[model samples]
Target: MTTDENLGKAAIFDLDGTLLDSMGVWDQIDAAFLAKRGITVPDDYMETVTAMQFREIARYTIDRFDLDDTEDGLMAEWDRMAHDAYTSIVQPKAHALDYLRYLKATGARLAVATTMPAGLRAPALGHAGMLDLFDAIVGVDDVGRGKEHPDIYLEAAARVGVPAHAATVFEDLLAGVQSAAGAGMHVWGVYDESSAQSWPAIQSIAQGVLDDFAQAPRPLA
Candidate 1:
């Protein structure tokens, strides 16, 4: 449970598995990309790159599989493969819209802090009717670091005109929860099937854990 004192004045949300039920799209992309090169997706590959940014993932894939592809080439291919799904097939996580509306009605500033690239995020959020709901969308490209660092979360709070301690971050991954908490913001862990292995760590770090956004405490009037 998140007490009123911990609710904060701004809400920073993670995109993929947190607010958008879209991790499965990435799984399909990984498998298909590897399959195209006559390689099977390694069982541990997705886990290893779970918290990485697009460029990082590209570099890792090229090196790990001894592929002859440049990072830029791989990234472009990935963006092409996943763009349509992000813009059309992806949907909000259970009750995510309701919670966003609840926070909006509370007069709390809202922002997105995600590792997703801007090319994918913009259309996806726009199609989902969420683009205008946020005060800002801070992507991994903006910070040049992954969620293991507090850069993205800190910037999101700053952009939303909230102190780090006066913001709450809703995240679905252990790395994201740690990043926001490391930035001195309150963290609320959202459950995602893709992150099941890291659930215990997320529970231990977050101020609250939610299987669904509907379970979130109502914003204070």
Candidate 2:
């Protein structure tokens, strides 16, 4: 676990699996999308797209399956399938709100750096009553690269007025944890059943791993 000395003045978060219990919604979207075409969702498809942006996922889906659909078309369909669920059905992960509140009370700045697009992210965060809590929300579109690069995390820390090394990033995916750590930030990996396959890798690299936010170590005195 990271000690108080290692904690930063700003905390950067990944939305989907880290803060919001919404990865299941994406799984359903993938299943429903492929089902419409009479194609069963491949077991490895979700894992392959776990850290990709919408457009990247769209391109990968089309190429991997040899589908004739345009990238934009696939992206629009996924957005349509996910919009309502994100805005209405998705909830914050266990103890997430409490953790955010604790950070806020400690005078730490908060920002969301997520692969989810603005159209879906804004509504989900607003519905979860967390939209106003963040000092900034950086989406994949905001950066030139995805989580495989450190651009998004760097931008998030900059937006919140923190240096990369002085920012702690909360993420659930190995790609994200790697990105933030690559950017010289301390990473805390949150657990999600959907990402169980990568837990060992995540644990090995992250400064800390949290099975639930309730068990998150206090990062401030």
Candidate 3:
């Protein structure tokens, strides 16, 4: 755990798996997409795209399946599918709302930096009853790059009117954590047992690993 002072800290969160229990939606989408085409994806399909950008996942699926649709069409289809699924099944992660409220009550600036399109992120946040919680909501379009690049977190900090070094990023995917860490923010890696086993360099990059946000330690005075 990081003993470094947490003064002037802002908290930026990755939306999907970190704040919402929605990682399984991706696997369901992949399975349904492949089954519609009469091809079966490998069991590790979700692992292959664990932290992938939406466009990257669409491209990979297109190439792997020899999909006849244009990249634009494929992305549209997937986006629509995800939106539908979110409306129907997605739920906030355990203690997610409570954590956000706690941050607000403690005067920690809150923001969401996600690879998901704003169209999706906006409604999902509202659906989860968290739309008013964030000071800023940043999507891939705001950064022009995905989480693989550190620009996303950097831009997120900028939007939140904070410097990267003073931010704490809550991330579920290793790639997202790496991006935040690369941008000089302290990360809190939220573990999902179904998706990931271990992150070796977490001790170096993250403030701590949390099974849920409620486990985050109180800020040091």
Candidate 4:
């Protein structure tokens, strides 16, 4: 499919695992955080928190590890650990910036539907040279829930001046794909090692599947 087939549509992207190759930041944080308590990061930890909001992740962490930390305390610690990486180390996924530009040039409205806050997400996308291209950026905080709900995707499309059905969401997690598709939008699953285990499940439900942004729609012109 090409942009010619979906002109003027909004392209909503999930930041951490979809448009940006930044899931490693969380993995590093998880290992370091758990190691401080003399525990090793479990294999299922990342998968469990991949679709959760920061508060949810923190709460889950405290309960799972029997840690004596409140959600706020854990979240603050994570923010401190992640600030430097998001500001400097995180980068756009392969061909992602080019694909965003391609969509823009073809008159597709762009938006980010992410769990990352403005401070972190903005700099990361700016560093990747595509921050200014997005017409809107919405987060789970903006919707009061995680990607398990379609609220964020709906808000992003509305902010970009498109109806849900006219928007296409690019996501790396099955939860995100399911939520956006359930909202009556087109959902394309983007490849990310963090969600590799769900790739088959994602492929089954998503309207499309992409190895990278290169496989996404483009302008024939």
Q: Indicate the worst ten consecutive residues by lDDT in candidate 4.
A: 1-10
Better of 1 and 4 by TM-score: 1
How accurate locally is residue 67 in candidate 3, as Cα lDDT from 0 to 100?
Answer: 85
Summarize candidate 1's per-residue lDDT along 66-156 as a digit string, tens digits: 9999999999998998899988899998888888877776678889989887798888888778888888999877989888888999999
Clashing pairs in 4: none
lDDT by residue for model 4 (144-185), tens:
899999999999999989999888899999999999989999
TM-score of 4: 0.93
Residue 8 in candidate 2 has what lDDT? 48
TM-scores for the candidates: 0.93, 0.93, 0.89, 0.93
C-alpha lDDT values of all predictions: 0.87, 0.87, 0.77, 0.86
- Candidate with the larger TM-score of 1 and 3: 1
lDDT of 4: 0.86
Q: What lDDT, from 0 to 1, does candidate 1 have?
A: 0.87
- RMSD values, in order shown: 3.2, 3.2, 3.8, 2.7
- CA shift at 129, candidate 1, in angstroms? 1.4
- Order of all candidates by TM-score, from best down to worst? 1, 2, 4, 3
Clashes of 1: 0
TM-score of decoy 1: 0.93
lDDT of 2 by residue, 1-221 (tens): 22344234888899988999999999999989988888899899988888887798898999988899999889888889899998889999989898887777667889999999778888889998888889999988899678888899999989988888878889998999988898789899999988999999999999988978897767732
